[model samples]
Target: MRSLIVTEFMSLDGVIDSPGGGSYPHAGWTFKDVQMDEAAYDIKGREQQEAGAMLIGRVSYDEFAPVWPTMEEFAEYNAMPKYVVSTTLTDPQWHNTTVLRSLDEVAELKQGEGGPILVHGSATLAQGLAAAGLVDRYHLLVFPLLLGGGRRLFATEVADKQRLTLAEHATYRNGVQLAVYDVLR
Candidate 1:
């Protein structure tokens, strides 16, 4: 089976929302002071090469679908297949998109042939996937500042405990801690 990897940008206090400039009070907090370093660029390049398809939630898909297609940096990501997890979302205008209505559909998608399924910025769906033991890895870039409050990566009590093995880690000059974890099944 292809690996399902979840990547997130978080704050010191665990806030993950509005990193890409949503309506949240602390929106765009990530870009306030941090610039992309060599290490960060390397990681992004590596993920772009390895990810065959993107598995994301409705909200994140909505956010990315509109902007990424127009950005030069996101050209490759726009070309790759996108699987949006949503019950209310349909008729995706983005090229190479498949709207999935449930986690069962997501599981079915996982069984198909591909490289790693990259999950980005879909905290709720990702948490559901984690609970279902579908997540294979987690790549979190934790920033130094705290937002006091916002949506978190794991905001609720999961029914089961999921242990992770540290796979890789690094700290950038801009105070972003890049932590990679392998989810133990």
Candidate 2:
């Protein structure tokens, strides 16, 4: 079975909304205030390469697909397999993408094939994945600031708690802490 890894750029308070731009109030909190160094980039690059495929929720796919494909720096990530969980999204604009219409479809994909499937910036999807008991690892990039009101990374429903072991922890120049945990149930 393919391992499911959840990755997100969250705030100190666990807010994971609109880290991309200023369309929302939570936007620009991490980038405007924080500085990313080469060492941090290298670590992120290495983690990105290790995953066989990327899985995301509809909102995150919409936010990332447009930018990453055109950005030359993220060419490797652009070409990797992408699985999007969406019920209402009729057509996915991004290339090399597949959409999951139902919970059953996601289950099938999780059990299907390939290496670890890394999920990025999809809180709802992550919650669903967690509820389904599919996630194998949790990789979080926690920023210093806290957005007082916004969507959170955690799910409202109580999930079957899985024991997690710390895999790695690193601090970036900008005070962004990277925490990687392996699910040990």
Candidate 3:
């Protein structure tokens, strides 16, 4: 079965809201020029190579649809199958985009013989997927600073306690730590 992998950048305080430019006070903190080597690029390259499709919520889809298709760097993601889980998203103008309205549909997509269903920037959808025990892996890149006031990644919206096992860990010179966890059943 294909895996549902979540990848997000967060502050030390677990704030995953608006890593890019947005309304958050420390919005663009993540992209600031920190010392990153080839290992960092390797991680990103690996994720893209392993991803068969991308699973995202309406908010993420809205954020990405307009910009990603235009970027030469994200051509791989644009070419891959993209699934947006939304009730209101009726038409997707981006190439290879598909709107999935239900959790069942998301689950069904996971059963496909693909590499991985990569999910990014879907906080509410991540919570829902966590509650349903559908998230297979979480790749969290934790920055050195603390936001103290933005939306958190591990919220209490989950229905029950779910444990996680650390599968991978890597630390960057600029204090960004990549922690990969497997959702334990």
Candidate 4:
């Protein structure tokens, strides 16, 4: 079975919204507040290299589909098969993209042949997957500052508690920390 990994650029307060600048008032907080060095993004590069496929929510797919295909840095992601969870999305314009209607489809995808499937910037999808106990691991880049209010990584109303084991961790000079955890099954 393939592992489903959720990756996010999160804040100290667990806010995962608008890290790359969107409609949020505190948009672009990740680049603005943190004094990031090249090393701070090493994990991101490694994720791209290691990921066998990409999974995202409709919102994240909308955000990334138009841009990632044009960037050299995101070539790996562009080339990999991508699955977007959406009930409304009819046709996807991005290459190698497939629309999955529910989490059951995602679970089925996990059971199929593949390596680790990485989830990026799909906050709602990640939350759903976590709550459903479908997420196998998390790769979080925790920034030092807090936005006070925004969409968070963890949901408050999850039915059960998830136990995690720290697989790896690293602190960058910019005060950004990489925390990799494996969800205990």
**Best candidate (score: TM-score):** 4
When 1 and 4 are scored with TM-score, the better candidate is 4
Please list the C-alpha lDDT of all candidates, in the order they appear. Answer: 0.87, 0.80, 0.85, 0.92
Following a full C-alpha superposition, what root-mean-square deviation does model 3 have from the true structure?
1.5
lDDT of 3 at 113: 94
Error of 3 at 78 (Å): 0.6
**Per-residue accuracy of model 1 over 58-160 as CA lDDT, tens digit each:** 9998898889899887776888999998889869999999999889998898898989999988779888999888999998889888788888888567789
What order do candidates take by TM-score, descending? 4, 1, 3, 2
lDDT of 4 by residue, 1-185 (tens): 99999999999999999899899889999888888689889988998898999999999999998888999999999999999999999999999999999999999999999789999887789999998889999999999987889898998677898999999999999999999999998
lDDT of 3 by residue, 1-185 (tens): 99998899888888888887677777777776355455654666788888999989998898889898999988889899999999999989989999999998999988879889888997889888887888999998888887788777788455688889999999887788989999998
In candidate 3, the residue pairs with backbone N, CA or C atoms under 3 Å apart (3 or more residues apart, or in different chains) clash, namely none
Clashes of 2: 0
Superposition error at 149 for model 2 (Å)? 1.6
Candidate 2 lDDT by residue in tens digits, 32-139: 767856665565687677878888888888888778888987776788888888887877878889888866777787787777788888778888778877888898
Give the runs in model 3 whose Cα sits over 4 Å from its true position: 33-38
TM-score for all models, in order of appearance: 0.95, 0.90, 0.94, 0.98
Candidate 4: regions farther than 4 A off: none
Worst 10 residues of 2 by lDDT: 35-44
Candidates sorted on lDDT, descending: 4, 1, 3, 2
Better of 2 and 3 by TM-score: 3
